[model samples]
Target: MLLNLKNIYKNYGKEPLIVPVLKDISLEVIQGDYVAIMGPSGSGKTTLMNIIGCLDRASTGTYLFEDEDISEMNDDALSDLRLNKIGFVFQNFNLLSSETAQENVALPLIYAGIHKEERNHRADVALSKVGLQDRTTFKPSQLSGGQKQRVAIARALINHPRILLADEPTGALDQASGKQVMELFKALNDEGVTIIMITHDASVASHAKKILHIIDGEIIENKQGGAA
Candidate 1:
């Protein structure tokens, strides 16, 4: 399994005022899986995604990523796992305002100790894959919302991560732009890139091969063959 979470629970605050976020969450995702997690605001889906992406740990649970116990890893280890194994896409694009598209895409490679020459080459290739090769030198301000999101996607994939975790990827786009992003996601999934996307929109979720509906800190439904 690429990922496994058993009896997961997350809570915050002190003993007398503990606020539960996720409750008894158990899930398994294998290689090449394209899954969507659908939930309304305050449903704990973001917390679950944080755990899956190694950004946070469950208050109580067993999480195994590629057979390695995540609970046993330290912050540095978890950070390393996140840097090397997982790619994250956010609704806001998260690009450096001063950096060009190529520079933004190559940011992760800098931390990986890749030389400048190789970093630029890899970033260009990633941009090409996302159909943004011609926009490599453009800054975020120069691109449209959809183009910016594509740049984010290319940056996320630049490291060739084991899984792509997208949090409301299309939430910031217009109807047409969102449709284009979903089509790109489908293409990436078809190429065997595992994807786990979080979205409240049913139309956005339908792009995945499987959908997990979350409500009240619990998974209410697990539907298969979500894609049309």
Candidate 2:
């Protein structure tokens, strides 16, 4: 298993006001699997994604990545896992406004201590993969909504992460641009990049091979389908 969760639980606060988000949740994702998490707001989908990406720990329960227990790892270890193993594409293209596409994509490698030349090389290759090779010098402010999200995708891919975690990746784009982004995701998945996308749109969720429906903090359905 590339990812596994066992009886994961999350709660906020203490005593009478404690709000439990996930209740005895368990899940597994294998290599090359394209999974989509579907749910309405407040259904713990984001919390589940955070735990899977190692951005947050489960309040209780075990999380294993490639059979190693990550729930007990230190902050630095989790940070390393996040930086080297997982890639995140957010709904809001989280690019630095002042930085060019290449610079923003190079940020992760910089943190990894890669040399500048190699960093730029990797960033350039990732940009090329996203079909944005010509826009390497453009800042986020100068790009269209679709282009900015593609830049974010390039930044996420620069590290060659094992898993791609996208949160509402097309939410900010118009229908046409959103379809373009989804096409990119499909191409990436065909090349064996495991993806776990979170979205409320059924049309968007159709892009994955597996659809997991969450309701009231629990997984209520698991559907298998082709890409949209």
Candidate 3:
């Protein structure tokens, strides 16, 4: 398995005033798996995504990423793990308006202490892979909804992460743009990229090979999917 979670639990506030957000969540994602976690707002999908992406720690659980127990890693180790092994795509497209597509894609490399030349070259290659070669120099403001999302995808792939964590990736786009983004995701998944997408849209979730329905912080369904 590429990722494994066992008996995961998440709670907020003090013990006497504990508010649980997740309960007994266990999941396994093997290499090349294309999984969608479908849930509406307040269903705790984002909280789960954060834990999977290493952005937040679970209140209690064992998370094994690539067979390494992430629950035992320290803060710095978790940061490095997230930087090198996981890539995140947000619904907002999270790009800097002042930076070009290439620059936005190269930001992760910069944080990893990569030299500027190599970062630019690799950024170009990543953008081209996502069919955004012509938009390398374009700023976020200059791109359309679909193009912006493509840039986000290119940025997420620049590090060659083993897993892609996308949270509501198509939420901000039009129907046509959302379809385009989903097509891109399908292409990436077909190319053997392990993708875990969190979305509320059933049509959007249908692009994945498997569907995991998360309701009220619990996974209530798991099955082969083609709901589009």
The numbered model that scores best in TM-score is 1
User: Please, what are the lDDT tens digits per residue for candidate 2 over residues 1-228?
Assistant: 999899999897799899999888888899999999998899999999998999888889899999989966899988988999999999998999989999999999999999999999999899999999999999998899999999999899888899999998999999999999998998999999999999877887787899999888888988896674
RMSD of every candidate to native, in Å, equals 0.9, 1.2, 1.5
Q: For each candidate, what TM-score against the reference?
A: 0.98, 0.97, 0.96
lDDT of 3: 0.92
TM-score of candidate 3 to 2 decimals: 0.96
Model 1, 155-203: lDDT tens digits are: 9998899999999999899999999999999999999999999987787
- Model 3: per-residue lDDT, tens digit, 87-146? 999999999999999999999999989999999999999999989999999999999989
Residue 43 in candidate 3, Cα distance off native in Å: 0.8
Clashing pairs in 1: none
Candidate 3: RMSD to truth: 1.5
Model 3 / residue 222 / CA error / Å: 1.6
Give the distance in Å from residue 215's predicted Cα in candidate 2 to where it truly belongs: 0.9
